[model samples]
Target: MRNYFIDLLTKEAESNNKIMLMVGDLGFSVVENFKEKYPKQFINAGVAEQNMTGMAAGLASEKFHVFTYSIANFNTFRCSEQIRNDIDYHNYNVTVVSVGGGLSYGALGYSHHAIQDYALMRSFPNMTIYAPGTRSEITNCMKQIFKSKSPAYLRLGKTLPKNFKKLYKPNHCAPGKWTKILECKNPDSRKCILTTGAVIDDAVQMQKKEEFSNYHIYSLPIWGMQYKTLQAKQINKWDEIVTLEDHLEDGGFGSYILECNSNIKTAGETKIKLKSLNKNVCNTVGDQDNLKEHFKFAH
Candidate 1:
């Protein structure tokens, strides 16, 4: 996912001179391509995440589309104030790029876990949450991010499978929209699995079980506070909606979805289920797969 981000940014920077990238003294081997290609547009902030975020905001104020990159926790929790005041508050065109989201850096311990990142970022009124579930979603999300001049949080895993089943029918994505991955043939089928970020893989695997054959699968790669109003209409169409995410249950994708439909009368009767990582996983130390097993999210 990090490689895809850099490659896409490098390509986009060729024509978009406003595109600038800053790092918190990380992304050594992976970011070199962009650094070498566009030296003037790249900067190493030397471990100062707060300052890096502020710098990105300053650059955005100057009409540059800046991207601040670092490990998930460093780029978010460590510099949240700057992100809120400097970038999100002012509606700057700065994308906070967080690599190793969720427990991707589990081997490094709880300090690096990004399980609560969505809880933090979504609170910002102007922030767009881009949690791509597939390689194609990553590409589509980046394209949309570049085209819009708004504050965004791009959460990425440390590594991703080289190939997977293509979920999006047209292989494209849009903000506040859910792409149909697998469609149910039964017209009466109303239960479906909706996911954001890499958990889409788990949802896909779950759909193959005999008990879940009637369930369809969908992935929502981009969404946030501004897009909440769009949810009620979609939710109205389903009798049962199961949301999955790598983050904790509280304030995660499922919570956000429920919040969106909280006021609707029919929402009371709709079966809304949430499948997220157990908070207990926070104390464990292992790779992503190991952590998933600990949380019982692995299939």
Candidate 2:
């Protein structure tokens, strides 16, 4: 996923010099290709996340679409004030690229944990959250990011799926719209496992379990507070929705879905179940799979 992001960004930069990438001291080997190919459009902002975000806003004020890249917690929580005031407040074209989201960097401990990132990023009124589930969804999200002229948060995972190129379908993705990934044998099944971000892999795994075998699988890659009404409408079509995410339940993707239909009038008859990471795993240290198992994240 990291390699794909750099490859896609590098290609986009070729046609638009206004598209720039500013990174902290991290992303060394993963970002070298983009840095070497687009020297003029790249900046190494050292370890200061706040300053990097401010600089991104300044460049965005000049009509440039700048992306601030770094580890999930550093680029987000560490520089949240800058992101909220400098970029989001002014509606700058800055995309906060957070790699190693969730427990991807769990071995480094809580300092690297990004399970609470969505809670912070989604609170920004002008910000759009792009949590692509597949390589194809990543491409679709990049298109929407370039089309919009506002702040965005691009959450990326550390690893790619096995045989991903051949396994994923090349599908189109739209904001607030569910992209159907897998269909159950029952054509009229209204029950589905809906998810966003890399946790879509977990949804697939759950489908193989007895509890979710009859559910269709769907992924919503692009969404934000502004899409509530759209989400309610989509929610109305389903009889049951099981939302999954790697983040905590509070202010996470599942919570967002509930908020969309909170109003009695907007709240349909659909049964919505939220499956998110247990808070107990926040401070634990382990590899991605082990940390996830500590809380039974996929269950």
Candidate 3:
């Protein structure tokens, strides 16, 4: 996901001089290509995440589309004040790029865990959340963020499959719209699993199981506060919707989905089930797969 982001950003920067990238003293091997190609547009902001975020906001104020890149926690939690006051508050065109979303960096311990990132980013009024589930989705997400002029969050995993089959056409995605990935055999089956990030793989695997064979699968790569109305229109199409996410249940994708329906009088009939990582793995230190097992998210 990181590689794809840099490749796309580098290509976009060639045509659009306003695209700038700032990092918090990280992304060594992965970011050098962009730095070498567009030296003037790239900045290594040392270890000060707060300053980097502020700089991104400052640059965006000058009509530059700035992207602040770092590990999930450092980019979001460590510099949250700057993100809120300088970026989202002003509706700057700054994309907070967070690699290693969810438990992707679990081996590094709790400090690197991004389980609560959605809860934090979603609270900001002008923030747009881009949680892509596959390489195709990542490509679409990058294109959307590049074109969007608002403050956005791009959540990515540390590693991803390169040759996996694409679930949805990348160009068909739009903010708050759900893309149907796997259709159930019976057209009458209205139960589906809706996922927003790397958890889409788990939902696909679950659908292949005999017990869940009748369930469909969908991925929502883009969503946020302003897009709640779009979700309300889609919720009535499904009788039972299972929302899956790597983050904790509280304030995660499922919570957002429920919030979208809370104000609609007719939405109470839909059964929404949230399947998220259990808090038991909050303190565990292991690889991504190991931590997922501890949280009962393993396939």
Report the lDDT tens digits of candidate 3 across residue range 1-299: 89888999999999999999999999978999999999999999999998999999999999999999999699999999999999999999999999999999999998988999999999999999999888878888888998899999999987664435756555668999998777877768989889898776678777888867888988898999988889977988888888889899899999999998887789788999898988977878999887887666824
* Model 3: residue 294 alpha-carbon error in angstroms: 2.8
The C-alpha stretches of model 2 lying farther than 4 A from their native spots are 163-170, 264-268
Compute each candidate's TM-score over C-alphas. Answer: 0.95, 0.96, 0.96
- Tens digits of per-residue lDDT, candidate 2, 1-299, equal 88899899999999999999999988878889988989999999999998998999999999999999999799999999999999999999999999998888999988888899999999999999999878888999999998999999999987765545634474678878888877776879999999889886788788888889889988888999887668877888889999999899999999999988785484658899999988988768899898887778878
Winner of 1 and 2 under TM-score: 2
Per-residue C-alpha lDDT of model 1 across residues 109-207, encoded as one tens digit per residue: 999888999999999999999998778889999989988999999999876643365545445788999887767657579988898887766776777
- List residue ranges in candidate 3 displaced over 4 A: 161-163
- Every candidate's lDDT: 0.87, 0.88, 0.88
TM-score of 3: 0.96
- Please give the TM-score that candidate 2 achieves against the real structure: 0.96
Cα error of candidate 2 at position 244, Å: 0.3
